[model samples]
Target: MLFGAIQALQIITFEPLLLQCNLWLLAGIALFYLLESGERTNALRRILRVGVVGWMFGLVLAAVQILPTLELIPRAVRGAGFDFDTISSWSMHPIDLVNVVVPHLFGDPYTLDRADYWGESFHRGREGYLVSFFLGAVALLLSILSFLSPRRNLQRTLLGLTLLSLFMAAGEFNPFYRGLSEHVPGISLGRYPSKYFLAGALALAVMVSLGLEVLLIHEARGSRARRGVLAVAFSGLICAALGLGMHAYFQSRPHNLEAWIESMADPKRAAAKNFPVVASQLNQSLRASGIFLGLSSFLVLVSRFWEHPRMSPVLLVSVLAGELIPANLRVVPLMSDRDVEFVPEVITYLTRRGPNEIYRIVQLDSPLQTFSGIWAPNRSWAWRIHFTRMSGQPMYGIMSGLQYAVFYSVDNLNTRDSDELYGRAFRLQGADGLNFLGRLNSRVLLTTSEIPYPGVRVMAVLPTNTDRKLKVYWLEQMSPRAYFVSGVESVHSHKEALERLSQPDFPADRMVILENSGVDTKPGDEGAGNARVLSYQDRRVLCEVDAQKPGYLVLLDSFYPGWQAYVDGKEAQILRANYAFRAVEVPAGKHRVEFSYRPLFFYAGLALSCMGLLFGIVSIFWSGGPNGFKAVLIYLKSRHKKLKAKNGLLA
Candidate 1:
């Protein structure tokens, strides 16, 4: 139940990629159980049965989140899944393997200046999925030692998984990954194949633990212990040699060193101050790898030479800590409280506004960077790919509307709730695109560039730390958050409505484009009716509409599943208006029109979760002995068959 909750919470609160990691962990456990041998077969079966039951229980526990997610999946940007090129974009470059032992082979941005580091992908206008794949030289040595251990099944399962993970991380570079992506059900659901490194890292950690067990139990003076020591020492020599060789190869030719620096994304940096720092980074990392390996070798030798049982474990732990501590520290960039406190002037101006009305803000320049890393294939190239770091340079001055109550129409981070039809309307180029923002109730536009369009007034121009200034513009033509539209244009589909909205002449404020027919949108007084928002919450919105004549009360919010409309305490059908917003037909009188999120799928899932919880409690009671659950299942099946037979005779 806890695991399922964690998985569901991860999917809801965090990126789906994290849930993939949890699935991989489950796969590893299943593999471990499947590889079990000898007289433990019956025990393994019982354990597997419990695991299966627990898995189902977890699913039921998470059904509330899952059901809503399933409903949203088809409408989401990635509903159709990702193409091969996109799925494999951030795969680990084969050369990144050096980081397996020498983590700083690619200079860490955390430890060094951004321009000082030169990773492989950045030159190609791409960034790696992870900063480091360091498993520690001690861990690597133990993983190697596991091959010689007597537990064949355990060794094979872990090592095989580790190897497979490496291949999968290779992504497009590996034909096996390509085959798996095409044939495997869940493989295509994930992107950035380099993330598979987590599985390999986990497998190696487990193998290290197992190797430690073998080392601790064996006689220090025994032949097996000696062989293990020899193996460790030999592996250290190889790591040291590889490190030295990398440095030596670069030093062999002046052009090799120059070419390496020149290949960086920033050519000016390559020629200027960053050249020497970039050149020495790899060399220093190699030397450090050699130093670490040599130290591990000495530590292992001391553990072997010493007769004490605790000596081996103590020294091994010390060696592992020595390696891991520094590497882990470099993973996170050190920042002062001042840096955290620093807020852009533009952001400060926006957040300091009165809370009377709710409207969205659009960051015109940095739409791609919105939500941090949610990318869609259908998204325009102007909305840059998430993998590209723009040559390690800061692209935008202020990432607006990320956290504050200020919402953004185009780039606010909620991925599933985004309506593609409305997105398509906004993604239309030139003036047509900016026009759609008004329809979305976007009042303010935060941009680096000045808008040439009419009615877009410059509200404020604040100087930023960068070369560019942050300009805040007020859009005068924007519609209210909730308004009553007199004109309703019925369309056949979302495509037709989108096409109509794409035209600059479309009066989106006074008119609504609804896909559904039979809405009693009686011709309203063009300028008579008024709608005032009484409340606007995340899940619910209440508006008082005084319609002079029956018309549509159009709410400039994304029309999604579970949002119900009510007029004067009576339920009313909400029409998909203006490509992606909600529309309810109001009568020619003062009426309370409420829009509330009450998804049936959520309630259905809640009911299932309750049932599952009750079933789990019942099963716990029935689980009287080791084989009691199995016996209960057998009896239930027989009883079901007998009841079926009696029903058939009655029929």
Candidate 2:
């Protein structure tokens, strides 16, 4: 029960890709159980039954988060899976294997400027998906020693898994991984193939522990010692040769320290111009790694000469601590509150102006601006602002807004409708784009570039310590969060609506574009309607609408599942409006409308979870006072036999 709950909790909190790790651990447990059992056949069957049942129970326990996620996946951009090129990105290059021993050969992204990271998968200010994959020189040597130990079968299994993980980590470079990603069912769902390196790292750690046990406790002295020394010597020679080659390559670059330092100030030029710094760091890392390697190798050789094998643990621990601790420290970047905390004047300006108003703001600056300094200027300030959701390029949530006029990258978590609308909205710049922005209820736009559109007031020009200046523009004709639209333009489908939106004169401010054959909630006067948002909360929104005749009350929020609309005391159907927003029909008078989020899947999942909890409790408390599983099985068998007899009598 505990195993099932823990596994369920892991899936609930993190990506489903973590199931791969859980599977590996489960396989290990099964193998250990089989190895220890005298009656292997019976043990295998029993353990398999228990494991399957436990896995199923885990799914039930995780149903709460899982069901909602399952509902969302179909609407998500990556629901089906990613393309091979996208999924295989951030794969570990075969050349990056050197980093296992010489960590800073490519340079550190966190400790130094991200530009200093001269490695693969560097794009849009992100140096790499993974920065480091160092497993220590001592760990590597000990892992080699594990192969020579008596538990050759276990060692072989470890070696196979470690190699397989490394091959998978190679991703695009490996033909096998490429084939698997194309043909396999779930392989394409995972991104960043270099993440598989963690599995290899885990395997090596286990191997090192086993190797230490063989050396210290088992005392494999003569032949094992000779083989270990030979293996370390051969590996050390190869690493030394690789280091020399790298040194020669870095040596060819021009070393103009002052010039490189000056060029590092420019974010765009930093990566190319800062090669000298990277080269210098590489040289230092090489020297330091060589020293550690030599020291550890020396200790291993001396341990063979030492009479007492018990001292082997001391030397092993010392070598690992000396090499690994410093590498660990160097890879992690520490920041104080001053480094992360800052509020820009633009945000302060927005907050001061009608703080209670229900509206959203978009930051139009490029995400690469984060590379301007050690960190992005006032990036964390986005968290403090209410109603206004701010982000640059890598928008997190579904409602991070159509901040960018055109998404330059495909990293956004956008619906097909919103993506189409935003893409076309960029082409419809000037008046049309402004109208669309107004329809989105975008009141303020903070950008590095200046806006040249009409009715856009220059709110402020925020000067920062760097060369860049943030220009804040406020839209004068922007609509409120909730408003009554007298004119509702109906189309057959999202495709048709998108085609219509692409036109030069799409009047988004005066009318709402909905995907339907005909709109019934039309006002008698076509202009006798006014609506305002009474209150806005995370899960609910209240609005008051006044109309001379029946009309549509449109809310400029995402038309998502689970949100229900009610008109006064009666339930109302929420309609999809303005490509991806929500709307409901209101009668010909003043009335209050409420929208509350209460998804069916979430409630169903909760019920299932409660049932699971009850079963867990009953299993713990009942079933013959001891051996709960056996008692439950016996009760199930008796019930099955009774049901069989009753069916025979009925027949």
Candidate 3:
């Protein structure tokens, strides 16, 4: 139930929070359950059964999404694992614990100019760690109180989970995370260890609830109330001291805010213009911290001096609301009308070009980077900008409903051949590079700068809502989506094929490489057969070919598993040609060739899902009545008797 609730809430954004929370909950439950079970084997078995059922329920519920993901994940870059250095980039620091208790200690990093300036210098653009895990001082105090509750085992288990999450969140700052990533199977899938903070937050929430219940007990006498007051007072004093110390440290720094602002007036130093704004926000945070501490102290005094039970709960609730509501408001600001204003002209223009036209558009400048200002920022201002710029480019193509040559996603399956093609088109200069783009069926090129390619004609100069200009060029000789080649060349390796492709006069349209050494074909047979594309679709292609003799028909499509080819209604072997495309041999005379994508794993998963659904329905019907248990026993006994009779007959 907890996992389901978390998953449903997290559907708004697919982050690792739910996964972290689920891991913590399951581990804590299993550990506590095991310890409590002791020598009782039946108890242990019941716990294991319940756990298994819950896990299987989760799996079955998510099978539709999981099945397709399993098929595609192995083909992605994340399948191998991320580099340690990259994964550690978002790690938390030991000092960042202050922020967990005191939230917005430096200021809101998601805003345009609110981040800790000094922290960014040493933390590689990260303003501060633990900013995302802030639960306020009130929650912190409650969590501490949970330790003294009667439910010792549950509290201890939660505390252990909290510590484990904190250690993992520290990433490279601690050794445990590194060791776990190396030894564990799915642990390496997480790029940001700080995401584990969600588990810590979940544990703390439970602890806070337990603690609050203890405090709210009406029967609590004078001493118990006094102790609670003392705890709150101590927490407030500590927070006050921390805030004052932080302010002193910032004041002692040699960098002068006035001078920094003056320096940014120079056009060359415009990048530092936001520094002053950040400094002001930091000062504001300092003031806010002092106010929070003062309020906490006042609440502690009220709880101690006053005896009314109703008043204590009311004051505590008011104080918590006062602290959290502003924080929430600051983090999530109202959206402006301009936020939704995108480049409609570009979308309209692309839509006007018939959707069935099987050609791709290549954007010279990554749209994500170019349109970073439009996307929501992250916890760290610098990282927010970087992430938005890197990931936003694909949105342009998606919004316009236009096929783009370059795409990026969590599961990016960029093969070596595809990478080479992309690099040659973008990095290489002159007509050779432009010709490669044409061969890749990129009919349109969108760039922020001019290119001196003769084959491309300037179509339009479109203006974006952000006041940026985009130059659109149309390639005169874009290749077909599915083409054929009559001649075949035997290449020993990808390197050899690449070398052959680099030649000035290499006939990309006429000749293609056959990787298998067994398939002997002469490179000189360039015009042995003729081929034309008859129909083209997203997953299926049809072509008509006339071969003078035995020749190969090559299609300019990435050769991946599950793609099958047929020639004249007979199944044919699909070879990986030109290092990354598909090819098939055809007999003499006219013949129809077809290519279709049909993954067997997907079908198998669908069948299994159907079976599971049927079984669930039958179980529900069979277990509906009050005598369901007796019915089940009888059914099992009958099955056992039938099996015994069958065995006896066989004997």
**Index of the highest-TM-score prediction:** 2
Of 1 and 2, the candidate ahead on TM-score is 2
Provide the TM-score for each candidate, comma-separated: 0.81, 0.83, 0.80
Ranked candidates, highest lDDT first:
2, 1, 3
Candidate No. with top lDDT? 2
Tell me the tens digit of each residue's lDDT in model 3 across 37-132.
Answer: 766787778767766765565455455455655666676565566777766767876756766765554445554433223344324454444444
TM-score of 3: 0.80
- Candidate 2's C-alpha lDDT? 0.69
Candidate 2: RMSD to truth: 7.6
- Quantify all predictions' global Cα lDDT against the true fold: 0.67, 0.69, 0.64
| Candidate 1 residue pairs in backbone clash | none
Candidate 3 clash total?
Answer: 1
List model 2 lDDT by residue over 50-81, tens digit each: 78888788888888988988888787666778
Q: What is the clash count for each candidate, in the order shown?
A: 0, 0, 1
Ranking by TM-score: 2, 1, 3
Report the lDDT of model 2 for residue 645.
100
What is the Cα-based lDDT of residue 297 in candidate 3?
62
Candidate 1 lDDT score relative to the true structure: 0.67
Residue 186, model 1, lDDT:
65
